[model samples]
Target: MEFREAIKIALQSLWANKLRSVLTLLGVVIGVGSVIAVVTLVNGANVYVAEKIYRYGADVFTVSKQPRVISSYDEYRKFQKRKIIRLEDYQFVLEHCHRCQAVGALQSSTGKVVSGTHSTTDTDIRGWTASMPPMYNLNVILGRSFTPTEEEHNSHVAIIGTDIQDNVLGGNDPLGQEIRVDGVPYTVIGVGEKQGKSFGASQDNWVAVPITAYQRSYGTSKTITVYAKAGSTGEPLNAAVEEVRTLMRSERHNRPGEEDDFNLDTNDSFVGLWNQIAGGFEAVAVAIAGVSLVVGGIVIMNIMLVSVTERTREIGVRKALGAKRSDVMLQFLIESATLSLVGGVFGVIGGIGVAQGVTAALGFPSSLAVWSIFAGLFVATAVGLFFGVYPARKAAMLDPIVALRSEL
Candidate 1:
């Protein structure tokens, strides 16, 4: 028999039991769709996190009391509750690290700011060093950054954010103007340009002041975040982190083989941490999808078994009319494969749609690779072929005369 005739027979058989075919396809549809959605969500989160980190600059690394990416709430709480990185450590890095372009410390607070008739509530205020402007890629729009003298002497000068300038100063020249921060007055010496968004929040809306001034005003502790920008492109960030670790370890008086008190964060480790989180989710998704495929395989096997029992007389008639056993096997196998391929296509479409929807809703981006889609389809077809073999062989091995005499 021609291959076309086998395909036609398979289609006819499937059409005769449309409800069973549709029911069987449901497993594939659900499995593929769920896998797509999970992978898409994970990919979106990865993109969002990677962009946020890149925005911080490739040459920069930060050091704090704990690792950059904490895996659990308990770990976060432990870091917050512990005192590891200190002002003395920041000063040590500032003085000793030569390969660094600049070292700066950051102290953050949220408070109210009042300017003339306008006021902002619950605003962000970052206190750092004069060197921070260059280290973090911060650019001045209309005025200069705080001078080193200002940071050293705890000067009352401040830099106003774009949002503060727009809403409070009415877009006028804000230089040398007084703004009350939590009722403490400070003179604005510069205005930062609009920085747009970072990690979903407006970066331009925050205020900046000298670390000393912030500490004096807010009663902030000596502890602050220390950031260092490496000098060379090929400079090893991990080595830099190690250098910082060594300096910190020596200062903190730790014995050899003892874990250092402070935490170091670099780009490579940060990305690895993100991958660790994403990898967990991917594993779960693969397992669930595998289960779905197994269920679909069982359904296919059951349907094929029923088909073999029903087509006994037809198989006998075909054999009597010169059809070979291999021909009979191929026809049944092709039918099962065709059903799985169709279901797989529908599942792929559904999965992609889900992925797109997740990306849109979560404010993250996702890219679907061609290999993933093709993989889903190929696996589905292969599953059908695998599950169809037993039934196909059973039908092919039947004696022609015995099959013809059997009751339908």
Candidate 2:
């Protein structure tokens, strides 16, 4: 029989037993849908994380007393014992780091802000040097950032986020308004551009003030973070990082073989950490989904074996009519493949739908890639073919005389 005719016949058989075919395809649908959903979510999350990491800029790096993430209490203790990164350290780097295009220092804490009776429940309060505007991408949407003189003089001027402006200050002319942060009044000299949200959390829920002023108001107990950008990206950034590292190590009196008592983090470091987390999630999710595919293939094989049994008389008739064994095998194999391929098609659609549904409900990002679709279909078809072989072989090997004698 011709391949097209075999496919037509196989489809008709599937349609005739619609309920059974539907049940058989369920596993494949679930497996493919899960795989696609995970891939979409992971892809979107990777992009989101990368964007967040590079929010300040690609060339920017931060030097802090502790690493970005501490996995254990022992590690935290070790970091706590390290020398604190202070304003003096920041100044040293600012004055001497030639490869650096800009340098800044920042420290932050959470506090409540009040404007008359209107008040924020909580907001991030940051103290920044004048150089932070350029290094930190602190885009001032209203008025302007505080000048070097203001930072030097410890002026009580502030830059407020949209949350502080709209929620605490009533969103009128936020610039020049006075808001008290933890009972300390500051004149809003600037309003930062609105940063919408991330993972359902508001990004625009913070305020920035001069480092000098913050130190006096909040006390100088907490460690400060130093920010810097290379004169250029790529190689220059590496050169800048090394120059700073060498200077910091020498200043801290670290012996030649001893490690520096500080952490240097860039956008790529954050992205790499995210990738490690994402990779593990992908592996676990895909493994669970693979089980479904295996089960689906088993279900298809069982259905095909039953099909061969039911069509025993028909197979006998075909053999008596001079149908070659190869022809019979081909027909059964095609039927099995068609079943799997059809399931794969539906599975791809269902996977995309699942991804979209999750993204919509949770506010988690999702971006479907074209390759995932093709991959789903390919896996489905392979499963069908592998499982169909035994049934196809059994059908092809049936004895005409015995098969004819048997009744269904």
- RMSD values, in order shown: 4.4, 2.5
Model 2 C-alpha lDDT per residue in residues 122-154, reported as the tens digit of each score: 699999999887677768989999899999999
**Model 1, 1-408: lDDT tens per residue?**
566776776677668778987898888777776776677667767877776676657777887777766778998887777565666778898899866777888888898889889988768988888888667567788788989899999998888789899887787889988898888888988887786654345667778899888888876564678888776445466567678778878877878997666677766678788899789979888798979987988898888888889889999999999988998888888888877877788888998898777555544466676777887888888988999899889888989999899897
Once model 1 is optimally superposed onto the true structure by TM-score, how far is the C-alpha of residue 245 displaced, in angstroms? 2.8
Top model number, lDDT: 2
**Which ranges in model 2 have alpha carbons more than 4 Å from their true place?**
9-15
Name the lDDT value of residue 383 in candidate 2: 87
Q: What TM value does model 2 have?
A: 0.90
lDDT against the true structure, each candidate: 0.80, 0.89
